[model samples]
Target: MKKLMMICMSLLMVIGLVACDDDTEGMKKVGIIQYAQHPALDQAHDGFIDALKDEGFEEGKNITFDDQNAQGEGSNAETIADKLVNDGNDLIYAIATPSAIAAAQKTTEIPIVISAVTNPEDSKLVKSNEKPGGNVTGVSDLTPVEDQIDLLVKLAPEVKSVAVMYTNAERNSELQYEIAKKALEAKGIKVEAATVSESNQVQQVAESLVGKVDAIYVPTDNMVSESIANVVSVTNEHNMPTIVGEIAMVEKGALATYGINYYDIGYLAGKQAAKILRGEAEPKDMPIEYSSEDKLEMGFNESTAKKLGITIPEELLKEAKIVK
Candidate 1:
């Protein structure tokens, strides 16, 4: 009888050890789905991971991260989302409208946190900003359209006609174009839109606007942002001044940009994720937050400016972050 009792105690100890192992393995797992590879998106991801670490969820320790990039292909985004879901990630962090849409369609139960999305409502990912009314909520990179238009008028006083280029298929692009048209029109600047459905069409659209408009404005549309180099080359070749939606574009070649710091926006999203993880708030109860501060940076490519025979405004130069 004593031997049997000792054996039973040993069996209970083994079961307790197995239970502890299961609990340890059930630690939080997160998956990040990025729409494309770009400086802005990269910074946002960095900020998010940094925020997670700051909150004590270090990757490969208490948490695991599965990062995937769609490489600018929408179909690839869907595939990545499926894999992440199959992997049973506790949460999914989708960075951009396309990525968010892909993840949202893949799972209704998994909590999705989207960052750097321009217009969630227009993307149909949410019913409204006030109440996302779904399993998704995060930060927006919504640049002030009216403020950007005002900056353009100030930078180039002689600018009469402004040409805007974007991808027509992207809902964010269409939304930004509408805002740009109204804002520029209010300033008595005639706005012309050049739409492209693919990357190959970007150069042609940029070429079509050469010598026709005093300045060109490029919004934070994913398609246009991804093909900015091609558009910038064409615009520079034609000696046309360009305004951009994000500072990264300005650093690339644009004359000036009024937009948000994407990294900070990502950090904000990370904070929201922490809240969700702590069970402090529900996704539907959380409202989509916009960047509180906007940054105005000038990228004066002296060589490009001189090559185009355009003089950089001294006042603007004084306020510029980079004077090339």
Candidate 2:
């Protein structure tokens, strides 16, 4: 009788544990914090949602999303991150470095899947890229800066000197600028640089580079990308060819770039989020992912090319996506 009672109790405990697992069919809550409203970040956010849908976590059916935007403010990102953590989110998808840093700071318990962050370790969101060692893991949007510099030279052989403009506060932009500077110098191209602390200062800073350099190279800095029209206004008037860090920036009027697709990286991050939500994986165990180089695209601006009176190489034109 005693043995039968113990066996019955063990069976009941096992049933309760299985029932408590996250694999059970239940509604999940996901919080998304986007750092800004630019095209790249917007596409990332959209792709993240699409990936969740494909993973059987459709909004309003199995999952509910608490989407918040920081509007390019660090304080706002922190506030939103706090709210999401307090709300008991099943998982958090942070778009951009600022938002990811905010979410990682808010809670170490909640699973965090980040996108658009250039360096997770440098940003202190993860201990390392291979093994995150914490509750954060996602994709990095580290575009090929060396190849991009080479592309700039190919498009405009006359560019002997270039201006590198970026936002000072963005760590990702700062890192890319350092890499770009080295690459430019290696090709015997002189490099001038400028930094903007805010969007309102972009035009003035861009104007400062007018007579100093032959062309401009802008990285995937959120603040600079948001105010890209201002930079282009100056470049267009000067007939200067600008090489940007990503395709969206090319679409915004920069000359060209060998950049990764923000949507693809975001989709990869979303899949990580899905695994966490279903209790199939833990953030610390998942290795950080990157968009495959084969997925990189050469993007050029048609109108900008014509405006600058630059001739496109037949080989490049054959493989590039011409954005008018």
Candidate 2, residues 1-324: lDDT per residue as tens digits? 999999999999999888766444588999999999999999899989999999998777689999999999999999999999999989999999999999999999999999999999888899999999999999999989999999999999888999899888788888999999999999999988789998899999988888888999998889989999899989988988999988988898888989989999989988888899889999999989999988899999999999999998999988899998
Model 1: per-residue Cα lDDT over 236-271, one tens digit each: 777677888887887777777767888888998999
Error of 2 at 115 (Å): 0.6
Segments of candidate 2 deviating more than 4 angstroms: 1-25
The CA lDDT at 291 in model 1 is 83
Worst 10 residues of 2 by lDDT: 18-27
**All candidates: TM-score:** 0.90, 0.92
Cand. 2 Cα-lDDT: 0.91
What lDDT, from 0 to 1, does candidate 1 have? Answer: 0.84
